[model samples]
Target: MDLKLQKFLESTDFIRAVKVTVAAATPVILFSYLNLFSIGFTVALGALFTFSSDIPGNLRHRVNGMLASNLIATGSTVVISLATINPWIFYPVLISLVFFLSMIAVYGQRATLVSFSGLLAMSLSFSHSYTGWALLQHAGLMISGGLFYLCISMIFYYIRPYRYAELRMAECIVLTSKYLKLRGTLWDIRADRNKITEELLSLQIELNETHEKLRETLIKNRTKGGSSNQNRRLLIAHIELVEILELAMATSFDHNKLHHTFQEHPYVLNAYKHLAYNLAALLNELGQSIENRKKYTGKHRPFQDLEAFRKAIDRYEKQTHTSGRPTADEVLVLINMFNYVEKQAEKIKVVEYTFTHALHTQEPKHKDKELEKLLTPVHYNPITITQNLSFSSTIFRHSLRLTLTVLAGFLIGNILPIQNTYWILLTIVVIMRPGYGLTKQRSVHRTIGTLAGGIIAFGIISVVHNSTVLGILAMTCMVLGFSFIQRNYSIGATFITLYVIFVYGMLTPDIQDVILFRIADTLIGTALAFTANHFLWPSWEFLSLPTFLENSIKATRDYIREISVFYNRKGEVPLPYRIARKHAFIEIGNLMASFQRMTQEPKSRQKQLGQYYALVVLNHTLLTSAASMGSFIQSRKTTKASEAFNAITGAIINNLENAMELLKEEKQNIPVDKETKEMLKLRFTELKEIRKKEILESGGTQNENFRLKMEEGQLIIEHLIGLTNLSENIVKAVKDIRERQ
Candidate 1:
């Protein structure tokens, strides 16, 4: 194969784009042939529109954009067609209307808004030439086309639900595996920071997208009942597992950074590699189960004793090298890696249990309580009105801002005393955003794109004035070209400008001056949008950032406490740890987005950067502590001295709960003090002594049962100590950071 072909084949993005193009265009083609009005242009335009909720960082924007565009298009088409009389007046009016609509589309929440604007622009512009009845016919036709497209999309969604589910599951597994591999490699050597950052970002993006699609699937599956419910529960569990795994990965990153000097430790490297392989295997199996839409029955087999594997590796490393204190980096990495492995194991165990329970159960309502308990711990709440409202409010505010700006532009156009200047007002209404900041960023790109596009369109018209065939071909090429460049804002804008100019210019050659006026109209829309966003309904990043950071800290603390209790009691750690991990991920995600938005605010540069980096460091610390706690738990023997260990574990949990409460209250500074620290130390020491005495007493009894119990008890005690140490440190860190603020 040629290099170009090889490159194309290698690009999954390109493949996905092709799939979307075919899927979107196919319906338009079918409808057009069925005498559903000329959908040729609409099909091409829709195909060029690649915004989907399935893409991370783009969903909220796209959805909001779509709603705004739809409203503008529907409103503009109805009002403009009814009022406009002559073509001379209507032509400029329509162009001005579209120009403004384009601005709103750009400034609004999503790319869908742009599509709506395109539809309105096309309908209103074309309808200007139509008589009264013909205009109504055209409106009906356009509405039908829109409905058909939506129906097709929904149908496709249902028909291939499993494929999407499987794909999401597979992607999650791939990410977890990559994270494990990266951690292991980091243990062997100091890893490239840029590469690691890129990988982490990519995983974040992929996970967000997967999560959206999963939500959609769950919604669709709800009406199907029974098996669908089972699938939904499993999918939710899968998502939780991925979230926990991510926290563990973050821990690994922190460990590697803190323990850079110990990257080459043989024992650390061995343990990480072994743990990575096990996690990868487990993820692969889970993915397969999802793909097959079957229960994960493999868990019934004898579980792999990760602790024994770690011990063996440790023994081998110790035998080969003289004992010495590990460098700070090595210790950090080792502890982090061990912690991650432990969490991963716990996640798998919970998921396995959930699947097993579902498989054996017969009654649906009877299983609800059990299912609720399992899911509550994983942060898998079914979608609710409140959640929807919160998400919608963000978009609604942005859209309303844009709408006001558009209204302002229309008022300005009316005052200019230009023929069909009402179109300019419509244009303004369509183009303006809710805030000044977004408008400013979008205007710069839009202007450049429009200018370049206008020049190209003029050239095409001058070169092929009489050749309709060539004009249509140019349009087709532009559509495909724009689709390819849509990922880049400047490129997308340039192509869109060129495409729109060509379409409008083809309809009126005599008014070449309209291009200059259209540019003015766009500027007006941009100005309105920017002003509205900055002055009206302005969102402060600080409003959400503190809460997000605080919640994340609390979640981290909760996770530590749960793991500690689980180790000490030799009982199942309730679902809260998993839930806490999910909440923490969500909080981190919110913090990142809040910071990104804040960076756009004037006088926010230093604050945003400082806060963001601080949050990052905090997250890193939390992950490291969690991972270390995991390893500490796994290394201890617990069965024999279970009672003593349990008591200590209970005390630790109580303290952790208190610490979490204080942290939540922003009073984390109510210090542990010397007395508290000494008390904890004394209790831990007593627990250890009790375990030792039990071991000594059991030594003469060849009874395997007594020996096993002693070992179990010892492990439990060690695990509890690790958990308490981690919780205390994290609480202290949170307190320190809060006090500094």
Candidate 2:
């Protein structure tokens, strides 16, 4: 088998797809018995509705978005049909609805846009031919079809809740392990930065999607019994593991200067390899645990093994200290890494405890505080809602653009004495978008898709005409083709275009130049979309990206401070700790995305360019250090050491606060106290020495050992350098800006 096929087979995602497909078809199949026409309309409407929910953002957002889009589409269709009589008034109303609906469809609620758009199209298409009662009847039939589909999906969800959760968890674990392994090899890959960046971004996206899938399953199984509870715990554990894995990857990259040393040191390299393997094994075990939760009614054995692994990890840390005289910084790094792994292990332990209790008890005990601390919030801020509404607002702007473009196309077609004005309108509606890039991409795909679709449609009509059976078969093929297209943008569009052409051909038996007309209309629509997106109060991506990066940087600084404070107190940080962590992670993600967008923009903004680069570097450094610190805090076994570490953290927090304020205010700040500096210098130096000794003991070469020591030494120098530069630059920048103001 080809690689693609192998991957597809391995994914087992097809199983879920099959389940969804069946659920979707069920409503149509059932409704077909009641009314074929209703079934046909409902299936099309359902297909369109499916688009409304297939967004790539947070689940909560997608759900809310779907609801909003549906309301707009259905409500608009009903209101417009009843509210107006004159074709001129009705046409403008339709156009207005399309504009608003399209804007929402593109920017705000991506998942539901198609259904909303379809609702407008459907109302316009049938209203003139059908009267008030008939239109209401059709609407009722469509709604019933949708509800039926949703019910079937709900039934499937409940039947094997654990199955989806387990599958998702397993996939997440596997992908995370692969990502970690890739991290170790990244320095040696020699790939272009863009390629590497894309790979890393893709990995992030995959991990996020996995988290979403697992979260959805966990929510569904919240009230389910022992097995479900156990699975949820496992999912939580998996999430922590993934987070750590991501941190590890980022840490490795930040310290890429030590790549050769890391590669040469048997122990360091072995640790990394072991970490990946162990994580992979743990993930596998978790998958099995979920699978066998029902079969084995006893306490989870993996938790016991997990505890042992934690102890073994602790021993490894001690061995590093014993084998060589590591520097203070190296020691800190090692300690942090050990702590992070242990915390992950501890999470698994807690999960096990919760699951075991849940299995034996009638009512599962609430561990709200514990779970709350574990999970991070992933919600849009209410304060930013109005500002962020730009995304939705753009949708409205684009819709108007499309409507104008369509009107122009219709007029031009009529002026040119074309027989089919509807053809021009259809083309305009399909092709027109709000922006240049999107318009270009859509046009290319639509044209390709239409050409292919038209050919296929023609062939089908020629092969199977006059028979209802053939017509049904053709429709089924079209639906399936559209489904396939849903998986890939380029391919899906082609199939959909073909499907549309074929359906039109079947509906109207002899139209010789219909396909040709479609191609022309698509091109015209594409042109209109491009024109509108570029000229209509064009929103430049560069503006959005910089602001986003700035916000992310601020969020990261806050997160660092929060974590430091939490460590200093040596107690559970409130919800804000988790919230900060989540926000920071998301911010970094946004920063990365912004950086990508910035690259696409014209580079005339030199000041912005410098700031962007500096911000990216700073963000990367912050993420690496934060991960190291987090790991150290979680891994410390001794109470005294923990307390000492906490004290050290307190001092760091004081310094960080002063530094951040200084940076913000652009003030010539007082340097940290001599005592604090001395302490930091001593700790970092000692940590470096410890790490060097470990490298030598691990049978690393003199060059490798020397490089490792230098790397550690360099980090201390870099840290100091960063602090001084940041403080100075902030003071200058803020002063300059204030003076100008």
Candidate 3:
């Protein structure tokens, strides 16, 4: 019951590890049963390498991708096997092939899988003597083993094709629920708001990632056109999740209100915390329901704390006169804020119910426009071979780094005094990454895992003499190791080490010989990887911050331009604008991630660390503000009376451009209208009367859309005001950092 061990057991990755373990073992088990144990080593390795490409995608895409991987692995192994006897001719050919494929990985994830798997196949397939036909036959076995894995993935897909997507979406719900609980801490002035902000940003990044995955799932299903009911239900549930996040961000709570009076008013703190916990409980159950794919139990009991929260808010309002601190409108804002919390908390049950109990109701056309967009496949241009070859790109550096390290490992592994030298090469491929910090962390984890796994494997082999049972154990270790590899590298490494030990033990009975040599090979390979990553075209976060920041600003500018286009004329919010928004969010997320990585490095390497914090926080705020504009613009009434107001969008866009240059510590002159803020305020005042008049003329009553427009519009205006100040702060922050440098 150790906390860390328990956490590992509880992880979803553990379940995935179990699945991968079986899938990887399938080929070995089959070859052994077929009395082909000699080729099982080569075949299982081929299958395990193919597992690298077994990423999440739709059924057709997944099957096709795996098939292509098998083909490449087969061809690469045949070539490597045939050429090994003539190193003068084959060695350079092999190195060139590795570099080319490694470069091809710049295209994307799928490309990387194909290229890297091929590299693995080639490196591991070398043999001293073999007829061309004999090499073909062994290569055929390896190819068949990979195909065997395809069957495993296809079977699981048929069982429940959407299970992976469901699990991912469920995780999103669970995370959002936890974040809501964290936000509920905002009411307590005693909370570390800075730490909370950091956590909130982290959650935002997670949600952004989930959004992309879910979008891909929706697109994949839509193209296939099967089981519309479930897909639609899942899509609708996802949309509800989006709204929940938007509402969570929409709260304009006065942090200063609690600053001076949090101690004086325990009721305020308790009520907010009470609601936060209630929300957390509700969403947690909803996550479980989605995961289980069964009837939602509606576990949190809606409005369980509503009455008490209401009373607390009322009490605070009544005592407002005594403190003379909070204005009347501020109290109303808190009251209004409660209404949002209530509605959003209640939405969990409603959304969950929609999944099971079909509800047919009329909604605005814009209601499902987002779902439509999510269903459409994303437009992307793969990296051309030419672009990938460019030395300036990160992809090129990674490709070069990997190619050299692999070649070095290949040479050292061949020259070493070891029986199973391929283990050394395998460790190198699995442990090294594009980033120095990441590679270092992985090497440490791999070393620890190997020693522990070696001990475990040694103990098992010492007791068990039967090769059949030992083979099964080795296969099991393969499954567990591959599963946890990405999730917990050390654990995965440990299991992988055991797998190597037992797998070879089954082939040849010298346990001590295999274990000692495998450990030494691993040590040698990992050290080579470490040395190569540091010395070869090293790209650190701090060094590239300027480029990343500039790209982020450009993306932000595009997003703002798209928003303006939406304002000028709109028809369900153009797809281009939505795509722009997506890229904007993604790029900023990347920037924040890079800055986080920078913080983990040595102090001398991250000299601009302070400026990075300021810049990143402002970047986040800018995105949120644009998001607010998006939420409101869909319903806001724009007319010729305020056509001139679109000019303000131009002004803001100019400011963003200026900020981009300023972020690079470059001097630039961009005129800013000192009257821009005042002009927008005056225009908003004019538009307010016009909006109210239209609302009255249309129905003489405030509809939900109108209410949303009113609330969201004010939020948009406030956020814009915040954006201008944040822009000014960013300029000063960059200037100060430059001076210090």
Q: Pick the candidate with the highest lDDT.
A: 3
Clashing pairs in 3: 21-479
- The TM-score of predicted model 3 comes to 0.86
Give lDDT for model 2: 0.52
Tell me how far the alpha carbon of residue 535 in candidate 1 is from the true structure, in angstroms, after superposition: 4.6
Per-residue lDDT of model 3, residues 1-741, tens digit only: 664565455454665555556656665566678987567656666666666777776666667667878888777777776677786878687777777767766666776787778877766765334566787777777777787777766776678767777777788889888778887877665789889888887787888788777877765575455436666667667767876776676454567665565567777767767777787777877786676655676656557677677888778766876676644445545555576667676666667676658756534445354445554253235546675576677778877887788788877777766676676777777777777788889989989998898888888888998988887777778767866887788998898888878877877867888888878988988998888878898767887786777777778779878877887776676778767777777777778778877876667778778778888887777766676566556544533324534655666677777767665645644444668767767766765665566556554223555554445444545655665566566656655665676
TM-scores of all models? 0.64, 0.70, 0.86
Residue-level lDDT of model 2, residues 1-741, one tens digit each, is: 664564443333444344345545555556566767445555546434543343433334444554444445455556566545566686677666655555445333353354445544433443244358876765665455445444544465457545555556656656665665455455443646555545665566567656655654454344233334456565555556545654564354344544443343435534544554555455445444443333324333444544554555455446656778454445445444454455554554453344345544332446533443434444435443344345445554555566666557656776875655555565556555544445556667767776776676667667666645544654555555545644655566665566556555655756447766766666665666566666765555554554555566566567666755665556654557656665666666666665655564445522355555555555555555665444444443212223334444455445445544543435544454788657765765565565566555665333544444444344433443343344335434433433433
Question: Per-residue lDDT of 1-741 in model 1, one digit per residue for the tens?
Answer: 664455433333443454444545565457656865255544433333322322322223333443444445445665566546664675465555544444333332344345445533544353244447776665555444344344444455456535555555556655665665555555444568656654564465456545545544443344224445466555556656565555454443444554554445445455556666666666666665654456665632213556754675455446434555433233323443455566667776666566556554344545444434332121214342134334234444554454455446555766875434444544444344433445566667766766776677667767766645544544554544445553555566676566556656655775356566666766665566556666767655554555655566556656656666556555443556555555555555554555556667677423545645555455544554564454445444434334445455555555545555654554555645577567667877887777577657774334666545544454445456655665565455545556655
Question: Using lDDT as the measure, what is the rank order of every candidate, best first?
Answer: 3, 2, 1
Cα lDDT for residue 561, model 3? Answer: 82
Report lDDT (CA) for all predictions: 0.52, 0.52, 0.70
Better of 1 and 3 by TM-score: 3
